[model samples]
Target: METELLSYAFSGLLVIVFFISIALAFRFSDGHVRLRKRLKSRLIYGLPVGSMITIVTVLAVYLFLQGGIHDWDNPVVHPFRSWSYFYPTGTVASGFAHGSPSHLTSNLTTTLILAPIAEYIWGHYPDGQGGTNASRDQPWYRYPIIRACVLFPGAAFVIAVLTGAFSLGSVIGFSGVVFAFGGFAVVYYPIITVVGLLVVGVVRTILDGLVEPISFAGVTSTLPGWTSTAVQGHGLGFLIGVLLGITLLYHRNKRPRIFELFVALLIYGLTRGLWQIYRPLGGNEFVLYRALGVSVVLIGAVLVTATVVASKRPLFEGSSVTQREAGVISLVAILAFLIGPGIVTNLVIIDYHDEPADDELAVEDYIIGYDENAENPTEFVFDAPGTDETIERTSSGVYVASDQRQLWIMDTSQNQLRSTGTADIQIGGIGWRETVTAERDGLQVLGAQSVYAVELRHDDQLVTAYESNASTANIRIDNRSISFAPDIDDRFTITVEGSDGVEETASIPSVNESVEIGGIMFRASETNGTKFISAERDGTVTTVAQEE
Candidate 1:
């Protein structure tokens, strides 16, 4: 009984839309095609209205099917009806569907405003001269309605049965219908709702996490994107909208059809690329995501190569941004490219060093990864020198490279002795035996010394004064090989060689510069910042300075 009523109502609605569109089309022009074009615009305007109507009408019918809108007049039989679960496929449309009069009237008001408008536009489609001026002559109505009637119920049913997901059956509404209306409009259609969602994201986050989460531009609540549940459908719908927009630019003529197809495909690919990066997926689909990512990378690479070879001036001019829109878009594009692993070259670096080949490691908050087949790297450790400074590095090998001039080597793995050499013959560090890194400049420690001294930086203005107590043996040099300062800052990491004549070797980062037994202190006679800031018994503080 309910199905019959719904079928009758739908048929009637379809008839009304068809007649109105055709009547309007004919009234506008004697030439049917010309009139159809005129009607197309109106359909564009009315599609949303029709879609809104479907929101109401479908809800009412759905209620009846669920037995909720039972023949209450004859209270003997009332049907069961209620809200449904979320289904990714059709929830947006289904959301509009409801269980009773309250639902129908609620949606119908909106439907009245949005659905009829679209249906009215369906009236305009080319038909033979002296055509019936009805659904018979309207391709717009036939194609859209036919597609919706077939696609919606059928897709929902098939998907539900196959997946054993009953939620699919519970789906309702006009979104899919409106989508169809929009699909026919421009294919690149722009929906205001999407932009609204993006704007609301910041506001929504603020309202949601009341306990103070993240803030942006003084706005205490903002989500980091990915958290939005409706993001997927909204995204897909947006893509369809844009595609419709592009389709509007398509020409049906056979002559330019091939070219138009190429342009359309290009637009689709580009848009899809944008979508993929914009909507990120997690590691579950590692293989698929990486494959797709690589494909995009290759495409972009080809474009870049072509651009380089073509030899044209950069549109930005490099001095300053010529246009604000262009500047922002360019910045966003650059950031996306960089983050997507596009800025890398074969002769390049993941950071200042090559990436590791194996699975990436999450050390603290830092994530380091290499190209798929790139070389693996050792974990990094910092190198501490003098009193307070430490240099961060990538390799475990203890080495320093301030300039390209020299490398300093501390046998970090060996506590017995620290070593250094001229980066000339053996370049010091890298040897196949224990594993080391060789650079241009390095310092050498004799036998087992307390500290392997090397010139960190020399700054002498012809006549400079350096004060020192026993604690600050501030070393000064006019021009020298190298020297080491007491590792006063971090006592734990200070590598000490032995106890006796200031000779000891320990672990990493700590420089072994000892004076007393088991202690590494300033060897320099002057109190310079290079080693330590010391005060004599008289309570006078002194410092040592270095020149670049």
Candidate 2:
């Protein structure tokens, strides 16, 4: 406890020093002149109230709605994902809901840094300037407080809803909105937005260190971070934000340099994983198009550059619309094309006839089961033209399916459950949540597959959902083979089968123990980091079962 306290104190001190150094640098830099002048003129009027309110709202959703306050690490995530267009609750809450505390913190941290910059571009006062407009003829939106509190927050909420609605699949997290903030900021301050991205990385690292000053980990397997990313959702949010920013710029008669805009868009796309265009081939498989993704990013940068910096002259000799206007129309068309397919896909009703497993446990509307290489219950089935390859995909894991929400997902993969030994699935709606724990117990045997059983526990109700067949070892003693099998009582038993058609069964002995069955003594022992069971008969010993 004392060591932890000291580590926290040291981390806090380091954070303070880092911020102080930043302050000192800003104080000495000549670039602070305009910022200082703006600050002095606006005083508290220019404060990022909208950004603060948005951040607070997101935090509140995570804390209360997602059950983060009760359990900081594990939140009710499955129910809050944007599962389908039919599920209104999920679609609405998905924008604010987070899968984990780290996810929420990383997103909010980026928002904390970039949102204020985007808000600054919007400004608190009307006329696109931070100045008091006391004229009665001024519109209500021109009021500083109204713009700071209402307009900015309202626009942000709209953006969030749009992102959720257009997202490709059942997606959760505030990253889409974070990317929107980046998109908006990059339009007005291209280079500064890049700098802000670096700052975000530093801040997130500091925060992680503060939370866990020391962490120990062993080599483990996990899917690549980019594999699961919703790149289409991110692209949609960024494009929408860029459109909004460009519209505002046009109205304000302002345009950033073409080269700067292109560079910023390209860099941001590459760094933020927007260039990771991929398609899920079900199970844990994905096909990534790296070359095509990079090409798309390059083309996007060029299009955005032309949209913002094109000349006011007509596109051709006698065209009425200007070149910039044409570019804007083309950009809007591209957004429509990107969103149309998602809308169509979401409208299709989910068919819930597919059963995940024969031995599924029903809790309310959820079906929990264990299966190996079963078809994904929630995956949308569609055939690609001119493709002979089977698009059918399979998953092997503990899965949870909900017909009402159109959710079919593997809550924990087989290998993951094997490594962790246990997993928890959180299910809930509006005001209530329940947890179902999946536990795997297994016995490894030498030269054979492991014998295992999967059990589910909800509250006090425990059930063995699935069990594997008994596995026999290759090594034999006195023409007798040893096999391991899982029993209904959640215990493993060792069976000795003799060539003479005699069999003896007994519970597997613990380490350093022995059990005599049919004149053959089975002893469990460990040596040189290997645990094995040995059979002794007539003063002769032979290895039977060993840990894989």
Candidate 3:
């Protein structure tokens, strides 16, 4: 029922945008003397509306192949939906992909609102049908969007890669490029800031409750649902845009000061490269949040220094933006802003992460060499212990195998395996060396040292239930109950009954201590820089081992 409502809402929003764009396209296409042959002006009026049509069409195709409106995080679609432009498939496809409806709307509101004004400022060629006007106040390149379309992707790619490599996370969405457009418009006309702030503020207010949470301008919040602002991406794009503005818009006739330009470029490159290699921007607590602050400071400093040094000519002072033009553009953007959020809200309101289990293949279908001749088709059949003992398949293409007291979880769809509870451990806190249970409804893996659970409703997203950064020793799992000591301070027990799971934490008296409860003894100790734990059953030492 909820899915149907959401789908209808999304379709309705798209329909609205479709009609608006068509109307605007017709409006600009009309044969008024004021509109005819004014290629630059016509484009400024039409490009954003036309872009909306393109966006809607592509998103409709994405919705179809994804099987639903809320399949935002499909792995195959993710590569194309967001900008991971450093990779081969991400470069050309990033611009077309959006993760969620809110993501699309936020970026769309900014772009559609600001892009027309930017186009008019940079692209408007007044002398109709004539050749290029060298004497015009603007730069020689008439179409700013052409240059912007090229630069925005490159900027997004660079910033996303740098952030992923140096900072805490990678970025997606059109916000960064929208910031670029904003930066360009602001540089061209400072008065645009008033309108820019008002629009973003109003749009954010109306839509903040509908999408991921956002912090106000000065306050900092990293709570759940508070999406990352991607400071690095936005900063990079803004800086690049500012540089372009200085070069093209500010100094029309005089030669650019090469030294200042070099300095500005060098500072930007150096900061980004260093942030990637050795991110020192953040102090201890603010490390994850420092990228944007650093970028803002550096970009501002570079812009100031460049304006002082490289700007040989005065700022462009051609035709001032009239009140009538500003009002019209703002009105168009307001309509887009109002419509965009509804589309995003409908598309992302329902989480469709867990699909039905009707497509379950036979357990033997995934067993290797089960039907093959026992006679050697290949040289190695190397059967190991525990491999044949316990093997199970969950509905979500997850295979759980216990081999040599180690548990392995394999995703058949991606051909990836994560092994735990062995001598070799991938995560630091927990050690697993026993049979692991794979639940079907949500496909959670329960082991001695670690517990992996996926939220079926959240697109099968993997979430850690019990993980510690410190080494966890004295692991034990019995009758679907798990207990382990993490570092020197505390002990934790995880209990599972049927499909429900819960965890409880208890404090320890000292580094070396033992607890006895309900005919069971759990002890923790350390020797030779290694943690150890032992379980006692009915006054007998049942298990003793080193923490993995």
Q: How many residue pairs clash in each candidate?
A: 67, 0, 5
lDDT of 2 by residue, 370-433 (tens): 8788676444344333121112347788888788877777788899898788999888777877
Lowest lDDT block of 10, candidate 2: 383-392
Candidate rank order under TM-score: 2, 3, 1
Off by over 4 Å in 1: 1-37, 40-49, 55-132, 135-217, 229-548
lDDT at position 281, candidate 1: 37
Q: List CA RMSD, all candidates.
A: 25.3, 3.3, 18.4
TM-score of 2: 0.90
Best by lDDT: 2
| Runs in model 2 lying further than 4 Å from the true structure | 1-6, 19-36, 39-44, 128-136, 281-283, 348-358, 379-392, 510-513, 525-532, 546-548
Residue-wise C-alpha lDDT for candidate 3, range 374-475, written one tens digit per residue: 111111122333222112212223332222112223322211222332111111101111112222111121233332221111124222212233223333
| Residue range with the least summed lDDT across 10 consecutive positions in model 3 | 364-373
The TM-scores of all predictions, comma-separated, are 0.24, 0.90, 0.40
Please give the range of 10 consecutive residues that has the lowest summed lDDT in model 1: 461-470
lDDT of each: 0.29, 0.80, 0.38
